[model samples]
Target: MALAGVRVVELAGLAPVPFCGMILADFGAKVIRVDRTKVTMAMDTQARGKRSLALNLKTPEGVSVLRKLCVQSDVVLEPYRKGVMEKLGLGPEELLKENPRLIYARLTGYGQSGSYAAAAGHDINYLAMSGLLSMLGRRGEKPYAPLNLVADFAGGGLTCALGVVMALLERSQSGRGQVIDTSMVEGAAYVGSFMWKSRSIGMWNNPRGENMLDSGAPFYDTYQTSDRKYMAVGAIEPQFYSQLLHGLGLDDADLPSQMSFSDWPKLRQVFTDCFATKTQAEWRAVFDGTDACVTPVLSLEEVSSHPHNQQRESFLQDSQGEESPRPAPVLSRTPAQPCQGRDPFIGEHTRAVLEEYGYQPQDIDRMLSTGVLECNAAKARL
Candidate 1:
């Protein structure tokens, strides 16, 4: 694997941090999550393929142990509010000094140095602040948040992972690592570059749901079928649009011009009525191998059974029957794999990790006894 032998010390946090670590781990990096001894397990699905080391960083012994691990690790991922790590004396300045080649990454909603850096915010707030949220939804409806995928996972986690890989590539040439400051707000805006550029090209001046790709055209929207299930249509090109009309049993001579904005409402109604005449499955069969660019809008439960998804193994089920998406962007020679192990309980590998970091068995025992470290006895028994 591309990231084999790379060691990552991940400070446990929420979605973005664990997601970044997961991407690295999927590619064969050794990821050790530094969890808090007193905290409960986070609701982060990205925790798979990682080992946990629970320690109380408030204690000097815990801090000392983390510093030692950072010294031997290639990357240190921190996702705290700005200045929190600095207050804890574990900021980039301190950790990078111990390992000059360590990539110290910080992920946050705002950024390290911004007016709203210290303010509390979530994925929606970040997307709104980035102006991307204002462009979503129908014309008369309020802009809808596209779940948490945009800012949290895509902008924050995926962007940070890319930064880590780029930094590592640079490190091979410079033999030195650097800091990566990632803000979800900025990253969200960056990923929406096409939307911003469209405005300048006169292709995006209309309000939400009134633009070419924003469901303004009848050919690029979803229609309800007779069974109430939906079918998504993206027959944008002239040839594809002809295919869509042919499948709908309509001819160009019987309809208004395709590019006539004033005719969209009528065209949409015609398309909607035609789609409502058939069940989604019926429409799917009609467009299955055609260039109509029509597909069913599948529910979460239906996705795993889809023929294409099953053939590609896009989602993998674990031994416990819990399903999760597999690593993507398939590499021909060194494809990434799903995490082989289940998510670790808190402090499951504390003793082993400490010993690997050169701490004596006696020292680890003392730390555990003194409340500086913790180990999950149940996991240890296993």
Candidate 2:
């Protein structure tokens, strides 16, 4: 309920911007996603708790409707490359002139003014440009794209959401709005700040996969169990390492020094052979309540039943019976809630939203009839 009464106009986009808008919605903002007319909808986790208003932005009337929404919204999260919104006459300058208190947040791959500002890009492209891509993956393998989590969600979405909250807090004092130019490349670099800063002091002086945290150390990586399942291990400190050794029934005298990089291959083989003797469940039982910092590597299907995740109610099922992660960083007094039933279909609230904005029913009907707006009439596919 922190963002209760806050209205956000989210121009429907791909992963990052929608994720940022979802964060705002999770914290009680009234988020209206301006979706393209006839967009295909599937099981949308990011669309949770958002109202959809499908509009043909190619039309002048549709653009005017969007402008009206922006003029009345507290925040506008746009996900286009530079000048895309300006071409539609809904740029920050135009809208902020009409509404000085609007927080105009732009989520893009490159930025508004950089040389690559208008280049086509996805999460992988952004990560490569951000300089974090070179530091990921195994020792000698080509850098593995980590499923887009680094740039798309953590860096771009989470970073923009944090910026939006900070801007809202500042707006309470300044009584004015400002533009937030959030570039995914820059945001990814900022999120990987520790990796960048630590290298200066030799924390990451080694090659990409040779660092302690990046599976360089035998104790800080995953091991395959007898059942072909995996267990994640992070026994870095001496005490934890001792526990890990004990859990594996290995004597300290038989192993090399914990931090001896030269002996990691041998240590890792010893660990691999030890772990292969037991199933993941057996290993989990060995280290469950200990300080070994060992845990099973849960698959998506297994996450809902995991004890810690279940204890915290970290995931909840939607109307589709698909379990997805819940709103995070729980607040005591005003905790977030799951979507009551289902996310809106494209343009599910098109007419209702127009009426709420004081548009006449006749006008809305005319817009719908003229292809300026759209409402959900077809049955949703699952």
lDDT of each: 0.90, 0.91
Which prediction has the highest lDDT against the true structure? 2
Give the TM-score of each candidate. Answer: 0.97, 0.97
List the candidate 2 regions with Cα displacement exceeding 4 Å: 40-45, 377-382
Model 2: lDDT equals 0.91
User: How much lDDT does candidate 1 score?
Assistant: 0.90
Question: Residue-wise lDDT of candidate 1 within 61-82, one digit each (tens)?
Answer: 7888888888799998988999
Q: Give the Cα error of residue 29 in candidate 2, in Å.
A: 0.6
| Residue 7 miss distance in model 2 (angstroms) | 0.6
Question: How many backbone collisions does model 2 have?
Answer: 0
* Window of ten residues with lowest summed lDDT in model 1: 38-47
